[model samples]
Target chain A: MNLVQISLATGFLLILLGLYGALTNRDILRMIVSFTIADTGVNVVLVAVGYLPGREAPILDTIPVAEAASRITDPVPQALVLTAIVIGLGVTALMLAYAYRLFRARGSLDISEFTELKW
Target chain B: MNFTTRKAIPLVLLLLLGSVFYALFAGYTPDETLNRSASYYASQTVQDTGAQNVVTAIIVTYRGLDTLGEVTVLFLTAAIVGLVLAHSKAPKGRSGSGFLPSGELLTTGTRMLVPVILLFGAYVFLNGHLTPGGGFQGGAIVASAMLLMLLSDSAERFSHRLISRIESSAGLTYVILGLLGMLFAGGFLDNRILPLGSFGSILSAGAIPLIYALIGLKVGAEFSSILTSLEATEDSQ
Candidate 1:
């Protein structure tokens, strides 16, 4: 298949791996890393969606005046990826910070020990 | 029965996910822009936003609202983190033993690379609208630089006041600029407030480059502060 298909398959595999890690790994930090892998997969797929096999960057000087729109690659996905990147950064930072706080309070990053919230 | 049920969740999830993927691929029609509009966006970007980058146009103009929402989400996260990690009293000092040295090589390398990393981060942040990198990525890189310092030095306390002031002011400025756009331009967060200079010029794209720069500053400060706060509380506990 094409690169996009390969990326999709890889993203799914990553999600599966991450799911296994999140469920089986006891450490909060490890879980977070797995989640990041999952997120990276999604981001990769999203970026891949906009990938034009042969298209050039949509700069003005590259294409003729009349054919400018037709020759350039789709930029909307890049925009989406930009937003996703920011959101992912914010969320990952928060998650890691929370994990740190948890470590401080309990002296362990093992998530199973955090039963107070569950109860 | 126990073994059967234990296996059911994954089996069911796999089937459901597989079906969904099948349907998605079957129905996955690319946008009309898959055939067109890349160039349209590119040319219009040059003509309207005065930026040569169509990605910048889509980010700063076509999808500016989404960018605003992303910023808001970050603001809310900062507030939540602050609330959760807030301590009424000063941190109690760590009674535990000193940090174990991982390796002299890592420590020295991190010390040497901090300045270069910081410079690269600034460069990326400043040239966001013109380049592949942007505020968020650059800000995070800068934060990583600080993280290395924290991991290696562990003795230098970051200035909370400097970080907080930068964070709050940057967040406030974003909203105020959005309001200014509402007052003067097409709508909220309009990049059209500033003059659209010549295409590919750094001064072009109205307020986009400035906005992204501010975002970079805010994100870098906020992330550094978060790390410092975490380290402080961890040291005390």
Candidate 2:
């Protein structure tokens, strides 16, 4: 397969692996880590979708500005991915904080241990 | 749930999801050329925003308001983390006092590398418009320095008030720059408030470098705040 296909497959596989780990794991920390892996997969897929087989990065530092459109890959997805990565980090940190609070509250990290919200 | 069902649920769900993904992968076709907005940015980045990095141009110029909101979200996360962990923070004067001493090599290495890391982070954000690195990447690098310090020295106590000050001021300045863009140039957060200087140079890209520098500081502060909040939890143990 080509570079795009290979990367796309890798990204999807990572997402699946992360999802399986998250769903099967009982520990809150493990779930957080699994979700981070999934988040990384999403970023990789976005970047792969924006990839052009035979093109340079979308930076004008090296390439001539006049030929940028033909020479560079798409910058939109990359920009979106950058934002997504940062927001993902923020979300992970928030989740970690919540987990810490939960542990403090009940002295347990198991997801099943906290059933206050369960219907 | 029963043990068999618990194990089988994820497997069955994954199978269904995997099939969906397979269909998407089979049907997917890479585009030969840029889409409408991507093409616009590719062709017009240098002329419009004076940023050599088109991604930087899009993040800081074309989608500046979104960036502002992203920073706000980071700020909120940091604040909430601090608030949530505040009760567990070690009492004053008792923080960072009880841990075993870090070895000489780590301490010396961290001391030597921290300054260089801080400088590199500043350089990355300052040269954001000209290079692949930008505010977010630079800010993360800055936070790494803080992480290193915390790791190497158990007794190292960061001034929380100072970090918050930097974060607040940087965020405030970023918004002001956006307002300035509205007043002096095009719409909000336009980088053309100052003259788009000579291309490929550090000084080019108008207000991009300035705005990115502020973002770097703000992000760095937020990350450091989060790190300290987590680190201080060791005292609760």
Candidate 3:
């Protein structure tokens, strides 16, 4: 209905799509891409949950100090989202490196092809 | 399991999860007013950190240690990626297959754009305490510039020595600044080491800008290192 609800729904949908993709994709790279989509969904949900109906961003440049307490959205979730996004990038990079090594070792990009370690 | 069944299971699960999420989201309502801590941060950010950006203030001042840890995690990930891929030999004859020589237009454009992107990244991190952008955003921008260069010129190599030096010195300075804060200010990673100058100005926010600059440089270097390592493997192919 509102922007927050729309964004929240979109975020959840993205997470579900990402989960499905990650679970079903046979390619390791595709799975990593799905995970990244999930990370983005988590970030979107976080920022959306912290959103107030018509409040401005947590910046005080435009808003006067007297009205700031009532005008700005929550800063904590935004901060957390920022941190999470960076950490997610790092994890993705690590996963990509692992994929590269796996491909180098086995000459295959498919996760199903790398079943030598499977019991 | 059959291929159709395997695909159908995840789709069904996704649909179920999506419905639950939609229900949760549809029923939820955001609070009309700021919560207690949010109110405090909104009111006190200017007085405490002298940062016009409340999000930046919370990130760099109220939760500086968390930021430090995040940077360290990024640094560690870059290092681990390098370590993990160190022994892998790139396959021969694949480089020319997957990559082509850069066009003259791209080469010239990249040469022109690299410096501008680097300067913009510096500006973003430097003005972080006053604006919406910060170290992480700026560093990522810088790394993107490096990525552009790497993509355009397959032969060009980033200097590993320079990257490591920048990373180590920035990290060292960040630690020292945190220690300085602990000794001189209220506690560890406090931003009050220097005078909290004029509010809404670049010079304000005490040590926040400095710390963020260090973080930007460190993060940029780390990302560049990761790119370079990945690029090195590509070159050997």
Candidate 4:
């Protein structure tokens, strides 16, 4: 279909793929990678939702001031996505640190191997 | 439950979820016109913030507090990573003897590229108000430069004190700028503390570029610290 619809569909598919990987992968690092994929999907979907059919970016560089309001896509979602991507990076870094610590303590990277807390 | 059944269940659930998402998205249509807030930003960004980029205006001006919180979160994560890996033993060499020297090509290439990458990062953050790139993107680029250095030489060590000083000073400057906004402008983190220069110019947008530059430096330092800690752990092992 249109570019927006295509991007939306791809985003959803990516989320599903990431979810499946995260759920099935036994390795902590693999799961973290899967979560990052999911995060990317969420960002894509957010930006896609804010897109209008053929509107330009929300920049006033080329577009005249009079026509900008009608020509620009939603800026709010773009801003939100920008913040989300950075936060996702932070979260991913934290998870990786946790993985490193777990590996250091137990010498294993498998999530299933860390069941000592489960009573 | 059987192993095969357990595996199949998640797959089936994923399929179901995907179908649900597809159905929800299939009938949706994007509006051709901007909504209320989007239109407001599009029309007023230049006049209000003097930023050619509306998204930048919305990010640094309209949602400054969120950005501050985001920077704080990144800083916290970096701190936590350092703390978590603080006690790890140093990394032995590739053969478990001592630190191994990197290849000549890697070392030479890193030396050549690191300056260029750092310059690019500075450019991106400095022109944030006039372009699509911003503090976070530039900071990530700067971190990649550190990653390149780390990869090139295993024995090379970043000055932890220097990195922390840079991080703290940038963070403090950011806070003071926010306070300045509160005292001189509309509210916290306002980009109107200084004069909004000519639109589409680099010097315009008041404190936006300044704030973004500070943010980029702080974020870069934080990421560098994280990389250093991780690399330190590798050395201790």
Off by over 4 Å in 1: A23-28, A58-66, A97-119, B1-4, B26-32, B35-40, B87-113, B154-157, B235-237
lDDT value, residue B193 of candidate 4: 94
- Candidate 3: lDDT over CA atoms? 0.87
* Candidates 1 onward: DockQ, in order: 0.47, 0.89, 0.84, 0.83
Over the stretch B200-221, how does candidate 2's per-residue lDDT look in tens digits?
8899899999999999999999
Give the clashing residue pairs of candidate 1, or none. A68-B39, A69-B39, A69-B40
Candidate 3 vs. true structure, TM-score: 0.93
lDDT of 4 by residue, B1-237 (tens): 789998899999998998799787977888868888888888888888889888888888888898888899989999998888778645444322224666899888988999999999999999988878988889989989988887776325556788899999999999999999999999999889999988788898999999999999998999888877777564343
- In candidate 1, what are the lDDT values of residues A48-67, reduced to their tens digit? 67766666665555466456
Error of 1 at B188 (Å): 1.9
Q: Any runs in candidate 3 off by more than 4 Å, and if so which?
A: B1-5, B88-98, B154-157, B235-237
lDDT of 4 by residue, A24-85 (tens): 99999999999999999999999999999878888788899888898888999999998898
List, in the given order, the native-contact fraction of each candidate.
0.47, 0.91, 0.95, 0.89
After superposition, the stretches of candidate 4 with alpha carbons farther than 4 Å from their true spots are: B89-100, B154-157, B235-237
CAPRI tier for the interface of model 2: high
**What is the RMSD, in Å, between candidate 2 and the native fold over all Cα?**
1.7
TM-score sort, best first: 2, 4, 3, 1
Overall lDDT per candidate, in order of appearance: 0.71, 0.91, 0.87, 0.86
Tell me, by lDDT, which candidate is best. Answer: 2
